[model samples]
Target: MIISAIALSLLLFAAGAPAECLGEWSPHVVWHVAKIGKLTSELQLGPNGLLYALCGNKLIAVDENGNKLWESDLPDGSKSGCPVFDARGSIFIPGNALIQEVKLNGSKGWSFKVYQGSSKAAALLTTGPGNLLYMQLPTGLYAVDTAGHYKWMITQWDQVYNASTQLETDWEILASVGNDQAVFVIIGKKKEGYTLMAFGEGGKIRWRYSLGEIKQANLVVGGNGRVYATVNPKRTDDYYKGTVYAFESDGDGSPLWSYAMGCVDLTAPTPSEDGLLYFCADEKLYALNQDDGTEAWYEPLPKAISRPSVDENNMRYYLGTEDKRLLALNTEGRLDWNLTLDGKVSMRPMVGPDGYLYVVTEAGSIYKIKDEAPESDGG
Candidate 1:
């Protein structure tokens, strides 16, 4: 099932343009605290209105007021992308050897071993429809139900067409649940390039699309049913050339449009309320037409761009830089304000329910900042 209308509305609004531009903007730090261990992944807002931070081998839960709720250790090292919250309010952390479930009260629920062999690295974990949890292992993808029962497992060996060539398959980097409840994964083949595959409920392959020689891939599902992927050049010396591909959500895997970029977009494409796709790359923020893949506008940043996050009201877009700065941009692609952090920010800033932006630095510091302007006055 899709998210609730209220939640979807908020997401669309945040991704979309604001109703109007702001006159002046200022942000002030409300609170700052040091985490227990080095943050391993981005901060995820839980269903209980608490923020969960993966720090080394531990999971730390903190409130909006910067109070620590609870801290617990996972079964194994958690190098997975991020922990996801299921519909039942439980957090699932995919570790190297096992998948650990934690209840909202900071208690362990259950643990399931993903693989029996010595290698136990899980690259990605995401929630799909039917209350199912999807995981990406080195061998392939596995699906588990809410009760922690293994539904089905699909490996690269099962999907390869030619057995004699012995093509090597790379680890899955991106996985997302589409609007139709199908699971989408991007995998790399040694000589044949990259393949985007959609899997049905019973571990069946719905469709697969191939793109040649993709060095970096970032995927995002739009507010509409379109799937957007940014593929960078494979050669490290030439990172400026890239392409953005849009796929239909109906499982046919047909391309809607492909837009070539002047620079490689290392970040995922974000959809705005106005149906434009936004991404940061090479010290600039680019807005593209979602339907036709045409350039709408581009805004230059003071430093190389990092990941970006949109506010709930679609009023501002928050982004970080390699130069230790957090920036807020209005819908018109103009800079609203910016603040320098203690260290460089590699991750996107997360907007909390308490009307504050939670930013994490590379030095393991977390800061909660609030806008000095009033919300009603469009600051």
Candidate 2:
């Protein structure tokens, strides 16, 4: 998918007005992180610090300095999927009924149709395990090659297709659930009503769980082989409850533990190397023990929470919040330091490979915050 690069420097220069207004706030924002394009989904920083965003029907890739490298547009009328980079620098996008492969140079390689037009973003998963696995629209799971060719498609849940049941796969397993049956029990409002299905490597049904009507986000597989998810349900006359649930990663589908909170959405779980999974729920951030789902520590913030970023040394966690604050917290969940911004933080604060914290706001502002050396008193 190699394509010749055409210079759009003039267009970029013209669109640079938003970047200029970034620091209407401070001298603290040392660098103006440019918004190369409007992102429909959250932007992910590659290991090389390159920024990748899923903007509407296009995939935009930019350098660390925010220089646009390439932008690949999707087919008109086709739903957009999240951008995921495979090992070969190829991009995998599952949209509508098709899984498309994109080259690093912003060219289309090939595509495989996994579903008709029922594919949902929640059904797709990407991870490293010597193989690439993906979920099909409607109800199926498949693994394909770097070239967009299908390896296998699992139809074990074909019988549940008429029931609106959903399926997902991650790390190296698959899970499915029908709309009517009980798979896993969800105790409260936040804990209730979502169907989960788990499968093993060979397309075997490993486990099934039911959540009673709660919206689950950041479903991830932990190191100990447990599936962790954040649950949030719509507000009702009853008190709203938000929770994180951990299930046995192996196909047994048993519950490990659940933590409750107020109305909040948890960004995907950020599991630390020390066996702790970090999550942001409601206005609080928590680090929990993955083994039995016990709270190791938690930090209540001045505002609603955003996704967290771990420091280079893993000793600190960085998060932005609705109250327009950027904070760094120590491992103990104590505030290490914090800075205030003029605008709200709806985007996840990105910690670039260069050690700079990149933040963007709904007001179209981008700021790069870095640690300044301690000031010394004049002798």
Candidate 3:
């Protein structure tokens, strides 16, 4: 597992390093403090670099430099959950069996309740031509207005799950995947199978694809307006190989293409801005044409490495390994650079708005790697 110094230099460059940070290398570079401790549940960066996190039954807000701003606990008898911020700066958090909206200034906006249980996740969607679409995962899929007024609740798709599993124990809730204009919902039991339902802004089902099995992968939509999903066959005594299905947005049960990955596909694949979809198979990163599921490029890495992270603008791919080294590659599958860390890296490297590479480790350390000093011709 020894990484050469020359290899480390190339990896750093390929990882979207600025010009000033290249050349002469420091054995180990450490940055200032960002945040300590594992995030309680989920962490999201809000508008203007506001960091919001769900810590147990409380919602904590902090500045970019790890300075505490304020923490608001859920109402009297409520428990705190993950919060999602919409495009309009409204914060959505689940409390008291309802999904409540709060402004950034700590003022109550609106609240929506459900008879089944608390909300799992929520997103504010703005459809084409300035239409507002709100989605929440609770008892079922809800379509609502900005003011917390219920426009419609989808009961056509039957969903029922155990009250103890937080919506994943069994197939009790229908999940929505995609942005404002397009959403896909999977409904039905695990053993009995399920169906993929596509919908528009107004609670209309555009199309439905019979999956015939249970799928747990997050729904990914490409720029070409197609839905990419994976299905896993756990039981049912059938030896159906795991496959990734690509379906057109406007069609009815017509699979544009299907690719057999293996026994299962575990990760959610993201389509890059350059019309290339990236997914990890057999400990290697594979880039496929977003237009059609065809291999564009791939790079082999150690089996202990984590998933790949791509910079759509810089056209670089990054992967970290358990050997305390980070690998980088260009869009054409060329090695760029590799860097050694103080310890094993767990969290994914976050590219900040200020063009700094923020890599956080499992041992509670955030390294801000910046360009050391730009070289000059003695001018």
Candidate 4:
């Protein structure tokens, strides 16, 4: 009989709970070693089922057994951010002034020159419809086709009021693509304000919304064409006061709902398949209803949590913490297990295709944890 995720979690928790209440559930480590160089990006599972790791300036692909498949050196010997894969399975690596496309077999494809005469690197990379690639820079957004040819570019800037000169402020652009292939970006002007914009076909502006004077903000596009942004209060004394705002993706930025969260240093909100949003801040994990931003549940953590990875089939999520521990939580926001690692975990845990958990530590060690119980040896 198939047990529900909550029931399975309870059974596992009872079987694995320690005397100290640390919830230690030690899964068999398939492999643990510092194979890659100082890891600088979160591990990503590609469509080909190989684990892609960006370590320093090298991009390495490894199989489930930790066997090296191939490796490629990035341009300028460094990466500005994590790489993204297109619908055709080509990996796009962002660098200063260029975005390089690499094939799965470790060969180089065309390099698209996104910026001219500026040494500034791309802040984010995402894929859009029609096999198009989107790159966000401090100044503008560029859309390129699969062959690395420019489709369109958006360079318009909005004025932000600041004490200093009303100069064009460099924006921290956070971008994500929706199910409809529309590109959504949240522009956080330095010490000024925030703006949300949606780009449709031919890079046309579909909608724009202004969030006045937010100290920090992050954006995510939901499956149903809704944009969600978590904004922190701008005042230094009100650091813990934050809000999550939901807006229709296509309209004139009309609000759907807003939820107040006593969150400090909030991570990006992650949307699950069941219309729930998950985020962590101030050593607590919260689940909110995506339709109305109502509280679903929350659980406190021993340390600050990183971004979580959800397994939809099993209805569970995994996250790492600053205190060198990996945690697995059920959909009900209950702790299922926790395992202490060698070093602090700064990135989200990656779930491989074969149901193995892959994690990397700040000290550069990579580990693969089994997701299922091991078979018993007959005594």
Candidate 5:
């Protein structure tokens, strides 16, 4: 993944150019909160519209004006998962064998023990409908309600697979759908030599798909209500290869479609606007039809380190390269403009709803950059 460092440094360099101009936009820094801390996760927008930054065991909330509101300590230091909010405006954070809630005032609120005898945490926390919470540990998946009452739990995966192992598997709950049929339903995929499984309400195993032939897998839920998996096969080549697989989010059976690429894509398939899936492989950009996994097109470019982030207002794509540079690609898969940043973009440049680009660098600074282009005025 780090192989593109030198080649990417020489690629396009442009500031924030007008959305109309195909060339470049000179970068205009609106405001930046510099040297915040060792940022552990991407900046997440809180329910009250404040920006939440998770730094190890601490949580900091900052307002839109780059002013710090409050800083609080978490029960356990987390290396993954962003803070999620419930309907009543409480924050849910993950920790060792437990889930902690914090009120809007930054005071620690309630706690729920996910596992009876475990201290190891997967550190993955997600919220579903009715303020239902989902927590992932190395051992299993558990759910709790808004009042911290335990709901359902799934820990018998070895029995689900009809295979036993004393060692714990890191199971990530991918994109989920919550409705009448289930409180929070999910289709999950595990790492190297992975297994795909779908679980509905009460931790019922709806279906499972075995993909023992692959070496790695990533799952993303698309806007079209289906789960997409890009798996890499065990190979002897220099490049890591991945094929895209599509599965219905609510269905009980087989994958709808699969598309194999001739080149290599080590990242998960990025779902862009207008029903397009974008991925970079071997200095080339490829787009696929999200519904059927058909190749819409492919174009050459500098290697990409991060998946593309779609600017919904102007319909453009932004991606991070290996040499701390940001590249912009037009909707048609052509280079539009790029920008050089202070450090390897710790997180992909996110196009904010307020029409500014929010970027974080390795030095733990959140940069608010002007996004000049838009498909329509006053977005």
Candidate 6:
């Protein structure tokens, strides 16, 4: 795709956006890292900037040039959630029957079953506040220390703390940043009720808000001192309804604001750097005002969004789709540009530590991409 370079320059200056994010960022592959030729959709860029993936029970780390760093053998059924990194730079995997760890150098670290006498693998694992690992199992979310020891269980959220209040596996966890860094979670049971909880200091509950009965919910820590929560109130046959809410990351009481819409809507919610909450529902992408939950704009989507790219700048939003397309929506909520990939998007497009958009495909390809405004000079 070719565009007038002179006009592009003017657009860049008028918008006051960075060079890379000016307008119509035409995506071109900078390099190819791996081409395993098989579907390796589950890939994660580690803290050290290396791409990590699980092909079967073997965890492999690869560099930018497709060079293999190291491969470690994981226990059988070690595939589910992506690999998570701890503060000490160790990797954790949700194995079928255990919470496994891989050291920084690709060597096996600590491996232990989250729940004894059970073969059910963890549904999700994330590095939470206080340098602890939070694992979602059938019984509830369990906090595990770096040394592979079970620290605590948030099984029954109710104060009664008995068998009757058990909430099961309906919960999601995320950690906030800044001076008052903390952990937040959405936990509850079907029909009974659902609520959001914030943990601070020594894992003690700091605040809670009742959310009625929700089928699913997603929480995310935004750039500022805000926490965003989106929920699917109920699935009404062919249609679904959701409500997006925002809360002060550290303050108490009800949500700062709530907007009806955003949930199948079970995917993790995403917020842009400049304070806009992105929600994909009913085949449309809606951008909401972060402060007041007001609707800014929305664009029709070819398909439901998979994972969203929270670009460093507010100029553009990159979204992965099940339809094998990399979509770029401008601040005005228009699908101005798109790039076709070799296969369906496997992982969310992420801006690596080095500032390049890293996109992984189901065809086992890692693409390092740069977005440049279209130019008159054709490629």
- Candidate 4, superposed: residue stretches over 4 Å from native: 1-26, 116-119, 158-169, 174-181, 233-240, 373-379
lDDT per residue, candidate 6, 1-379, as tens digits? 1111132221111121112232555665666554543423356777787777776677777676555666677775564556777668888887664688887678787886644234343446666666777665545556788988878776654556645643444433221222245666665666566778776645667788887767777777777868887777775443345777888867884899987653446355678767677767666777887879988887787764665766665466777777777777766777766777767773568777666677777766666676655672323
Candidate maximizing TM-score: 1
**Which parts of model 1 are misplaced by more than 4 Å?**
1-23, 116-120, 161-180, 236-240, 312-314, 374-379
Off by over 4 Å in 2: 1-30, 47-49, 76-81, 114-130, 155-192, 235-240, 262-264, 312-314, 340-343, 364-366, 373-379
Give the CA lDDT, 0 to 100, for residue 329 in model 1.
Answer: 88
lDDT value, candidate 1, whole model: 0.72
Per-residue C-alpha lDDT of model 4 across residues 1-379, encoded as one tens digit per residue: 1111231211111121121223333355666655456777678778787777887667877666665656788776445567888668788887765788888767888888744334354556777656677777776678888888888876644433323333332666654544354777777666667777777777777777776666667777777777787877655344446878788866776679887766547777888898898888778888889988898888898785687777777777878889888888765778867777777886878776677788888877678776553253311
- CA shift at 330, candidate 1, in angstroms? 1.5
Q: Which stretches of candidate 6 lie over 4 Å from their true place?
A: 1-24, 32-42, 116-123, 149-155, 163-181, 191-193, 237-240, 374-379
How does residue 334 of candidate 6 score in lDDT?
71
TM-score for model 3? 0.71
Task: Candidate 4: give the clashing pairs.
Answer: none
Mind giving the per-residue lDDT tens digits that candidate 3 earns over 281-355?
566667777666777777776642444566665666665566666666665766555676555554445555654
Task: Give a tens-digit lDDT track for model 2, residues 198-245.
Answer: 545545555666655655445655555556777665652365577778
Model 1: weakest 10-residue lDDT segment is 9-18
Which 10 successive residues of model 5 have the least lDDT summed?
Answer: 1-10
Model 4 residue 225 CA deviation (Å) reads: 3.0
Sort by lDDT, top down from the best = 1, 4, 5, 6, 2, 3
TM-score of each: 0.85, 0.74, 0.71, 0.83, 0.80, 0.77
The parts of candidate 5 lying over 4 Å away from their true place are 1-26, 116-121, 129-131, 160-192, 213-216, 233-240, 262-265, 281-284, 374-379
Best by lDDT: 1
Q: lDDT scores for all predictions?
A: 0.72, 0.57, 0.55, 0.70, 0.65, 0.64
lDDT of 5: 0.65
lDDT of 1 by residue, 12-79 (tens): 11111122223476676766765435688888888888878898778888776666667787777787
Better of 3 and 6 by lDDT: 6
